[model samples]
Every structure is written in structure tokens, then in C-alpha cells.
Target: MSVTSTLGNALSGLTAASKAASVVSSNIANATTEGYGVRQVQTTSVSLNGQGSGVQVVSVSRNVNEGVLADRRAADAAYAQAATLASFYGSVEGAIGLPGDEGSLSSEFSQFEAALVEAGSRPDSDARLANVVRAAESLAGTLNDLSADIQSERLEAEKEIARQVDNLNTSLAQIQDLNGDIRLQIAAGNDPLGLMDQRQVLIDQIATIVPVSVVDRDFGQVALITESGGVLLDGTAAEISFRDVGLITPDMTVASGGLYQVEINGSPVDSTSPNNPLKGGSLDALFEIRDELAVSAQGDVDAVARDLIERFQNSAIDPTLSAGEPGLFTDAGALVDPANEVGLAGRIELNARVDPAKGGEVWRVRTGLGATSPGDPGAGGIILALSDALSEPKVVASGSFSSIPRTAAALASDLLSTIGAARQASENEVSYTAAKWETLRSLELEGGVDTDAELQKLLMIETAYAANARVIQTVDEMLDLLLRI
Candidate 1:
């Protein structure tokens, strides 16, 4: 090669190496930055007629995997949903109390059992019967209040999810717009690094709601897509919109799928199945809360109530008289059906506390049944039979007050077991969700920087830069000598 040509080649090499060093420095500077990817300056040989000329920087490329990145985004959305749902359920578990605690349902039922036994000792006494009635009402009230509170919390979560969805859609649209600007600039061969950085930050934010995949297009353009292969952004932008939707009815049930559907440019999309990769965000969490935890919890409450009502009514004591001789007591009434009441969800009230002070009256408990007194003599057989019924296995399911004399304690034990089972199910859900969250977090960090590795690359770049500087210095000295000759 001629001297001039050789100098030109050296200059080009120096420029290319300088650009490489700058890229390495940029990587090292952002080593700890979240969502920052390593940048590389691609170079190509400038050749003519099979003759080497010099090197030229082709383009700047970011280190990222479109498929893996999309997966991470989807995982992020699911993790957020699970995390939110778990947190809310955990709160419910706290309110209900843990296993073996006095604050638990089991402990409360034990208190109810004790009151029943006390009343059985003086079945003829109005005061004792009143106490029994009151205790039953209190227990029912507690269950009603707790169930109502759970439903309230679920409503709040639903609203929060709807708000978040709107915010997420706004962000997605913004990203699409940025994509358009980036493509336009790159098509004209302009450096859009700043815009690209902003877009990457937005993608990271999107990942927090749902996972996404980024496809590098020509120049500095990027196409954003969902893990499900839905085109979130191509050359143009699209709008995502959300609406406040209902999921559960007053009867405590999941509404139809249409209740929580999402829309894009007026077309509906399913957001239930995670595998189908619905829009990633807190919406997923709300859906699970409404459909899974809330529904199951309601079922558990109904089961407990049903068991109590059935058992108590079956074993309840009913006094009989000879030719209607004023009855054994004025309040010798049968249990009321709980299911007829708004709160019991079709359960029956077996033992309601009667207030004897307000005249011999039947107490109202669990929507129907209350304490009763037979004003006449010879009501012993009826009371005894009732007591025997309570002694059977189904009092927790039956609501029978008759077996209070012998089986009170056993019934209380069963109540405890049922409550424990419900709480355990809630805890299990929380545990599983935590594990899923950790896995997603690890995936997020996979494409993120390793500071140690980046620092090593920085060192190598620094050494090359120094060597290139020395070469330039030597070349300058040689040029000076030749001039002198």
C-alpha cells in the first residue's frame, strides 16, 4: 500500500477503535442501571476490488433477546397480579386469625358451645335460654360481618385494578408513539440513542405490568410486541383502553367472562388465561382475587353456615303439651331457617337468645329460629331429645341445640377444624404466589447487567485506547522525521 493509503487505513482504525472504546465506557457507566443493555459498535471493512481500505462503524446494536425479553415481560405482569392478590388475601387471613388462637372461629364456636351447655342445665329457666339465644345470634353476626368485610375489600381491589389498567394503557400508547418517532429518525440515518434509551425505560415500566418483546428494526427502530405475539407497536401506534367492570354479584359469585374483558381499538380481548398471555398488569391480580380467592372464601363461609344450621335444627328441642295446655313454656318454638334470611345464605338458626325480661318471647337469631320456653309441665322428654340430637356428628352442619347436654364440646372441636381448613387454603395460595414472583424476578435480571463482567470489559477497552494513542504518537514522530529528511 502507498504511504498515503497506509496512513488513511491507520486513521480509520484509530477512529473505529475510539468509537468502540466509547461504547465500552457507556456500558461501564450504566453497569448498575436497571433495564440498560450493553451497546456494541458494529464495524465493517471498507474494501474496493478486493483491496482493504479501512474500518467503518456500521451501527450501534443493543444486547437483548426478543423472545426471552417478551417472556420476562409476561412473567412480570403475572407476578404483579399474583403479588397483589396474595397481599390482599394475607390481610384477610390476618383478620380471621391463625390456627389455635382465641380470636379464631373455632375459639368463638367453643364460647357458643359453653353457653348452650349452661342453658341446658335449666331448660325451663327463661334467663338461661335467653343467654343461649344471644350467643347464637352473636356468632351469626360475626360471620355476616366478616363475610361483608371480605367482599368490601374485594371491591376496593377491583377499583384499584381498573385504575391501574387505564394507567398502563396510557403508557403503552406513549411507547408506541415513541416507536414511530424513532423509526422516522432512523430511516433518515440519524442517531436516535436518546429516544432509544427512553423507549427502553418505558419497556421496563411496561414489564412491571406485563411482559414484552422488542424487535430491532432497520436503523435504530424497535418494534414492541407482546409475548403472545400481539403487535403492541409496529411502524404506527395503537390505543389501549380500560373500563370499570364488575365481577361478583351480591350473592357472591363470579360474573361472566365479559365482565373483565379488555379492548384494543374497539376489539375485545380475553384477560383470564395466563398461558394465552393476556395484557400483563395488576388487572390479572384483580381477576384472580374475584374468581379464585373470593369465590372460594365465600364457599367456605357457606359450608360452615350450612353445617351449623343443619346440625342444630335436627337436634333442637321442641316441647309438646296435652291438648294445648299453654305449652311447657311460652317460648317453646322450633329453630328458624337461616337460608330465609338475607345474611345466612339459606341457613337455619337453631339457637337464638331469648330476652325473658321483655316478656316470654321467641328470640330472633340466624334469620328465623330463636329461644323458646314451654310454659307447661312434662317438657323433659322434648329437651332431652334435643340434647341427644346435638350430641351427634352433624351439629356443626345441622344447627341442632338438643344435644347440648353431652356433645357440646365435640361440636366446638369440629367448628375449629373447619375454620383451620379455610385459613390453610388461603395460606397455601400466598406461598405458591411468592415462589412464582421470585422466578419472574430472576428472569428480569437475566438480560440486565452484571457489573463485574462490565468492569472487566471496561479495563480491556482502556488498554486498547492507550495502545491506540501510542500508535498515533509513533505515527506522528515518523511523519516528523520524514519531513526532516
Candidate 2:
């Protein structure tokens, strides 16, 4: 080979080796960086007049297993959904109070029952009557607090949905901008590796909010579509919209137009629908809490409140009650309108006629709710009657609780049991999804930049650099000898 040809070849070799070393070092540095892909330097032999001349550095490319990454993103979304559901169920269970827990529904009922017995034995004792009244208030307070808590969770879920919607819109817009940048870079023959890495990070974030599938586009751009075939982004980002109701009540629901559902590209879609495009992510889970889980819990509590109200209102148990009068438990100070009993739990309170705190006499517990004056001192029929009514098995109303006849105490216990079972099931799902996410993540990492492999490539690059240097040195020595001769 001519000296000039040898010199050109060695120079190209050195340049290629330097590029390779740079790529290898980058891989090592970003091994643990989230969303960073392994890089490789592409090269090809240069030919002039059909003769091999030298080498040329073509381009740098990133290496990532798209299939594994997609699967990992899916698992991550599933884990997020399961964790959200588990949190809702756990919160409800805590509010309802587990069995044997103080201030729990069952405990409150037990205390009320015991107080009723004590008051009945000493109906003339003002202290005993007052104790009975306080016990009833405690029971009512428990239900009131529980109902309020459920509504609070629902409101929080609504707020979270709004936040996620805003976040999703912002991310989609950013991705669109990145797509334009990537397309321009690719067209200009630039690397665009860093922009691609940033895009991948944004895509992964979108996946956690709503599981999506990426579609490759012209000029290295991408389009995001949800698993249910909703196009979140193509050339432009689809605007996601939601209205936070601010304050959710037990009676407010999507069906009643009280809660606003999610909208996509200006088209309203029910977020709680089974066929929602953005299912299997935290967004969907939030809707489940706002529209389904909390509503059902409130219904259960309302049913218990209805049971309490009707039992005391029954003329068979309390003849003092008129045909339309409230019993020991009133719904917001009036007779419970069975037709409008959605938030009865929050409204259920101790009958004001029997509570001095509400400007009623405690003696009313021993006397009658409608009595004009104090009844006979030995008269404890009202207390015993209310007590017996609570313990008696009866069919409940208004809620999805079992249709079978059950006592008030049994109904409360069943509500707790149902919540506990659901919580357990959701936790099990969380465990499964979490394990799956970890496994898929590990598989993804296994395909990421391996330090050992990068180091080995570095050694090869060093060898190539040394060989190219030796070639140049040899050429220099040959020229020097020729000049000396």
C-alpha cells in the first residue's frame, strides 16, 4: 500500500476507535440512569474506485428491547392501579372499624345496648337516662363520621383525577414537542440520542398514568395510543379534560350528574365505564374510588341508618310515635324520606326529643317522644322497646346489603366483613402486580448496559487505538528512513 493510503487507513482507524470508546464510556456512565439506553457506534468500510480505502463512523444508535420495555410499562401501570384500589379499601375498613376495635360500629352498638339495659333497670334515675342518651349519640356519631370520611375520600379521588388529567395533558404536549425535535434532528442527520432518551422517560411516565402503545412514525417520531385504542397523541396531543366537583357528597354521583367524568379531545367519556380507553392505571383507579367504591360504601352505611331510623319509628315498637314521626334516630331532624335516603348516615342523629343537648329532656328517653310532660317514674317502656327493636332481626332497606333479615348489630358487622374481604382481595392483587412489575423491571435491567460488557468493549477499543497508533508510528519510521537514505 502507498504511504499516503496507509496513513489514511490508520487515521480512520484511530477516529473509529475514539468514537467507539466514547460510546462505551457513555454506556457505563448511564448504566443506572432511568430511561437511558445503551449506545453503539456504527461504522463501515470506505471504498474509493472499487478499492477498500479506510473506515468511516456512520452513526451512534441506542439499544433497548422494546418488547420487554412495553411489558414492564404495562406491569408498572397494573401495580399502580392495584395499589390505589387497596388504599381505598383499607381506608374504608379503617373508618368502619374492624371487629373488637373501640369506637367501631359493633362496639358502639354494644355500648348502646348495655346502656339501654342499665337505664331500663333504673328508669327513674336521671343519670341512667342521660347515659342512655349519650350512648345513642355515640352510635349516631360513629355512623356520621364514617359517612363523612367516605365522602372525603371520594372528593380526594376526584381531586386526584383532575391533577392527573392536567399532568397527562402537559406530558402529551411535551412529547409532541419532542417528536418534532426528534424528526428535525433525524432529518438533519444528527444523533438525537439524548432527545430520544428524554422522550422515552416521558413515554414511561404516560404509561403509568394510562397504559399506552407507542407507534413509530416517519423521521423517528412516535405516536401514543392507549390499550383500548384511544389515540392520546399522534401528530398532536389529544387534550384530556376533567372537572373536579370540589366537594363530593354521599348523594352526589355520576348518574345524577353531580360528578363530572373525563373527556378526551372534547368528547365526554365516562371514566368509570368498563370500556374506558384509559383503564388499568391510576387514572382509572381514581374513578373507581370516586364513582363506584365510595358510593357503594355510602349506600351500605345509609342502609344501616335507615334500619336504625325505621326501627324506632315503628309504632309497634313505640306507640308514642305518630304515623309519620321519626323514631329514636331521625334523619336530619325529620322523618327519613325513603325515596331520598342516599346520605342518611350523615343525617342520622339521636332524636332531639330525648337529648337535653339538643334542647330536649333526657327524661324523654324514659317517657315518650311525644309526651306532653314527664311520664311515670317507673315507666321505662320506651327504653326497653327501642332496645328490643335494635336486637330484633328485620329486613333492611335502600342499600346493597344482603336482603336477608338481620339485626342492626349483624348488619354493621356484615358491612365491616365485606369491606375487610374486599381490602384483602385488593391487597392480594397489589402483591401480584408488584411482583410482576419487579420481575419485568429486572428483565429490562438485564437487557440494559452491563458494566462488564462495556468494560470488555472498552478494552477492545483500547487495543484498536494502540494498533492504529503503531501503524502510524511505522509509517513515520518508514518515511524517516527514506529521507535519511
Candidate 3:
């Protein structure tokens, strides 16, 4: 090869080597960075007169597995959702007073059962009857508190969903802007590597909120699409909007698009319904908590309440005490003669209690009386049923209103078991998913990072640079010899 070509090749080698080193340094620096992926330098050989001159950097690329990234994101959503639901269930556990001694739903119901035995001994004794009533009241209060707690979690989940959607929109917009910048840089023949990395980071983040896919285009531009076929970015971002109506109460709607939206330039795009790839994220989890679990709890509450009211009133003394039998006392014992036996019906109330400060307590029974005077037999039975319902093993069917306490207790046990099982499943999932993530990370390293390879490249570049320096030295020596001769 000609000396000039050799010199040129050596110079190219030095430049390429410098660029590669810079990329390597960047990778090492960001190795521990969250959401940062390793980077690679692409090199091509230059030929002079059909002989290899030296290598030149073609481009800088990211070391990423797009499919793995998508999978991780989906997993992230599921983890978030499970975590969210678990947290709410924890609240429910506290509100329902699980794994405790006193005032717990199970314990309270047991106390009510004990009180009933005491009441049966001397049904005529006012003190024993009052004790029974108070126990029933406590049970009702617990139920009320539990129901409230579950409802509160549902509402909070709704709010969180709204917030996440808004944040997603912001992230997506930033990605579009970055894409534009990258395209411009690439078109100008500049290395858009840094910008690409930043955009990739953003995409990874977006995946944690929803599922996503990327389509590469010329000029370093990439299109962002949701798994649901919604275009998040095409030249510019696409617009996405969420329904304002809530999963629970239609009237109790949260703000729209607060969690996430895709905007393409200025136009909006609708994400695919069930086909939407955006599944794993905190937003998805919150939706599950708000819709499925909370709704189930609400239905249970309604069922228990409706059944209790319907059963006792039919057979128990009516809310209105007659001329012979006096109506039950209110807060005080002063009683007016019942206008009719139906007075007992109004006296019954579902009494439950819960910790207002905590998140998860719901479905405790409280005062059975709606508007009737207190201490009537029917009202008393309603109160007793509320107390014992948590421990009983079977559902209190509509036909057997008096058997509510036993039914409720059985149902409560079943509910608790269901939650326990769900929590266990979540724990197993987290472990398995974490292991899978590690496996993917290992696969990435196969072609991702190798110190030995980098060192080999370094040595090759150094040899070329040294050979060129030697040529210059030889040229100087020959000129000296010519002068001396």
C-alpha cells in the first residue's frame, strides 16, 4: 500500500478508536443507571486500491431487546396492579380486624354468640338483653367500617389511575420531541446516539405504565405504538383520551386523560380495546382494584344488608308496638305504646364498626334500626344477626333471615380465605417474574458487553497508530541520510 494511504488509514483508525472509547465510557458510566441500556459502536472497513485501509465508525447503537423490554413493561403493570390490590386488601384486613384478639370481626361475632346464650338464659332480664344489644351494635359497627374502608380504597385507586394517565401523556410528548431532534441530527450526518438513548429510556418508562411497540424509520426516527395499535408517535405524537366516567359510580367520575394519552402531531388516536398491549403498569392495577375487587365487595355488602333487613322484619315484631306491648326505647328508655306491631321493623338497624383512620376495613354490621325505636325483638335479632354473621359458615339465604349471623360468619371466612389466596399468588408471581427478568438480562450480555472484545479492538487501533508514527520516523531518518550523503 502507498505510504499516504497507510497514513490516512492510521488516522482513520485513531478517530474510530477514539469514538469507540467514548461510547464504551458512556456505557460504563451509565451501567448502573436506571433504565439505561449499554451502547455499541458500529464500524466499517475503508478500502484504498482494493486493500483494507482502516476502520471507520458507521454509527452508535443501543444494546436493547425490544421484545424483552415490552414483556418487562407488561410485567411491571401486572406487578403494580397486584401490589395495589394487595395494599387495598391489607387495608381491608385491618378494617375487618384480622389476626387479632378483641374487636376483630371473628372475635366480635363470637362475643355476640356468647351474649346470645346469656340473653336466652333470662330473656326477660333487661340487663342481659341490653348486653346482647350492645354486642350486636359492636358487630354492626365493624361491618360498616369495613365496607367504608373498601369503598375508600376503590375511590383512591380511581384517583391514582387518573394521575398515572396524565403522567404517561407527558412522557409520550417528550418522546415525540426527542424523536424530532434525533431525525434532524441524523439527517445532518451527526451522531444522534445520545438522543436515541434518551428516547429509549423514555420508551422504557412508558412501557412500565402501558404496553408499547417501536417501529424504526430512516433518519434515526422511531414510531411509538401501543400494543393496542394506537400510534403514540408517527412523525409526531398521536393523541389518546381516557373516559372520564368511573368504573364504580358513573356520577363519581374522575378527570379524563389524567393517566395517559397518545398524541400524534395534534390529532387523537383511539387505543385498541382488549387488544391494547398496554397492560402491565400501576394504572392497570388501579383499574382492577377500582372495578373488579371493589365492586365485588360492594355487592357483598348490599347482599348482606338487603337479606338481613328482609328476613327479620317479616317474623320479628314490627317497628310499631301495639297498645298492649310498648315500643322499644330510643337512646333513653322512655317508651310510647306501639301504634302497631310493625314498629319493631323500623327499630332494627345493621350496626358495624371500623377504624376510620385505616384504609381497609369495610362491611361491619351496626345498629339494625333504620328509623324505628331501639330494643324491639326484631331489631334485636337484626343486631344479633349482624354480630354473628361474620363467623357463620353458610350464606344467609333470603328465605332464612333469622339465620343471618351464621351465614354472614361463614361468608366472612370465605372472603378472607379468597384474599389470602390472592396474596399468596402475587408473592409467587413476583418471584417468578424477577427470575425471568434476570434471565433476559443475561441473554442481553451475550452480545452486549465484553471487556476482552473491547481490549482487542483497542490493541488493533493502537497498532495502526504506532505503525503510522513509525512511517513518519522512517521518512525523517531517510531525509537525514540523504543530506549526510
lDDT of each: 0.58, 0.90, 0.57
Q: In what order do the candidates fall by lDDT, top score first?
A: 2, 1, 3
How are the candidates ranked when ordered by TM-score, highest leading? 2, 3, 1
Query: Candidate 2, overall lDDT?
Result: 0.90
How many collisions between residues are there in candidate 1? 42
* Candidate no. 1 TM-score: 0.72
> After superposition on all CA atoms, what RMSD does each candidate show versus the true structure?
6.4, 1.2, 8.1
Q: What lDDT score is found at residue 483 in candidate 2? A: 100
| Per-residue C-alpha lDDT of model 2 across residues 135-164, encoded as one tens digit per residue | 899999999999999999998898889899
> In model 2, what is the error at residue 133, expressed in angstroms?
0.6
| lDDT (10s digit) by residue, model 3, range 343-390 | 221233432221223321111112233333233332344435433443
TM-scores for all candidates: the values are 0.72, 0.98, 0.73
Q: On a 0 to 1 TM-score scale, where does candidate 2 land against the true structure? A: 0.98
**How do the residues 113-190 of candidate 1 rate in per-residue lDDT, one tens digit apiece?**
666566555556656556656665555655655566567666776787677667667777777777777878877887
